[model samples]
Target: MAAASELRSDHALMLAVRDGELDALGELFERHHRPLFGFLYKLTSDRSAAEDITQVVFQRMLKYRHTYRDDGSFTAWMYHLARRCAADHFRRSSQAPHATDPAGLAEHADDRPHAGQHAASRDDHALLRTALSRLEHDDREVLLLARFQELSFAEVADILGCSVGAAKVRAHRALHALRDIYFRLQNPSRASSLE
Candidate 1:
């Protein structure tokens, strides 16, 4: 026989929590906390803040368990809550999100066989992170949801509280914007001339 947890979908787990089976939330947390933290880390460019917000998100899940509904994806619902938590964190801090430090980017360096290639890749990643950080919060958010989080347009729309078409449009525009910023960061002389 399948274990109770193995038999339960994410929605089922969440629904169980909503119905006062609070321990079920542990399974959901085990399943989602890493990806949630990754999303928060990328969005905030601050590992400590991401860790803090991650805990708050779960606390919120417990506090707001009654709001869970059967009609939506639990992942989408979780991200919706995550977005609000991050926004609230930023608001309370009264500061704009910043780029990750170049040194910090080292933590994400690829484990390639070639040292030279790894260094180049690391630099490229740093540049991209900087470019992403330079984008407006909303643009960064849409890209994070659609690209980094790998959420479908439907789920992205659900989390963003928009129509699917609108979510796609936002993702499209955000990608174009990121591309422009990335290339500009790569070519400072050309960027200055074009400005």
Candidate 2:
């Protein structure tokens, strides 16, 4: 037989969490925290908020653990919870998602790839972030799910509570929008050259 941890799938670990085995949640956290933090950081540029939201995701997972269904994808369900956590955070705070928190950003640099440490890299990061931020909320979200998170359309549909076809269509539209924004930000005069 495989080792206990080796044999336990994500769902099995989640089921253990649901059964009041809180330690199981730590296992889940170890497995997912990096990606979860990355997704949140992209969603909310404020590193502090992203960290907070990541923690809240797990807290909600534990709070709502009873609702977990064996048939559902654990990661999809976790993302659904994370999306709501972000929505709630945005709703409570008046700042735009791309708004800055300089001190926090400085402190959080080691947690993510260094973006502002060099000139060329800084320009690249700034342009991409600007393009991403210019997208409509739903558009940015769909793009992030498909491109950055690398989730399948079906999993995205589950998280977004939409049909798989709708998810695919949204991602396609979002990518078009992102490309337009990127080119425009790169050079206003050269925007049409991208076509």
Candidate 3:
């Protein structure tokens, strides 16, 4: 039994949550909600939808607490639930592949890219966001998990239920596809650059 004053690990907290400790569940939500929301928002490109999906992840965690394995990583488990929740949301919604994020394309870029680099950098950010929005769901998932979410290939593999090598391959293919889309958007005539 962990003392009340002692810092409990995420895994321990989640286990306690599985055992119906509300405080433990709260702790896990406090630690993880933002990352889950960010990943969902980026993937779905809808703030309200992301917020709803974030709540669903925790709700499902509580609803399916028994499924959580004590030996497994809590973060990975949360992401797995979040991914499922997002999938369900997509099934219920009619959003297009290029669902526009209300936050806009250049939101993540620097306040001002260096003058000489400004045009290119702005184009990069906008086109990249556009390209990402246009990506296939699986490819976008790989990008959000492995790159934006900063999860290692192993963690991503766990969340994705794929082997590490397969996750890496998928991410590689996704990056290639993203690059092709970005270039194709930049110049329609240059689509042959992919070949």
Top TM-score prediction, candidate number: 1
Per-model lDDT: 0.86, 0.81, 0.81
Residue pairs with clashing backbones, model 2: none
* Model 2 stretches astray by more than 4 angstroms: 1-3, 99-126, 188-195
Q: Which residue pairs clash within candidate 3?
A: none
Q: Give the TM-score of candidate 2.
A: 0.81
RMSD of each: 3.1, 4.5, 4.7
Q: 1-195, model 1: which lDDT tens digit per residue? A: 988987899999999999999999999998999889888877887888888999999999999998988897899999999999999999999987886665674553122335556768767877887788778888999998899889999999999989999999999999999999999889988667644
Off by over 4 Å in 1: 108-120, 191-195
Query: Which is the winner by lDDT between candidate 1 and candidate 2?
Result: 1
lDDT of 1 at 155: 98
Residue 112 in model 2: shift from native, Å? 6.8
List the lowest-lDDT window of 10 residues for candidate 1: 105-114
lDDT comparing candidate 1 with the true structure: 0.86
lDDT of 1 at 77: 92
TM-score of each: 0.87, 0.81, 0.79
Pairs with backbone N, CA or C atoms under 3 Å apart (clashes), candidate 1: none
Best by lDDT: 1
* lDDT of candidate 3 over 1-195, digit per residue (tens): 875614888899988888878678887887788778878877887777888999999999999999999689888888899988888888888554455752563443223446677666666777787788878889999998999888899999999989999999999999999988888978867745533
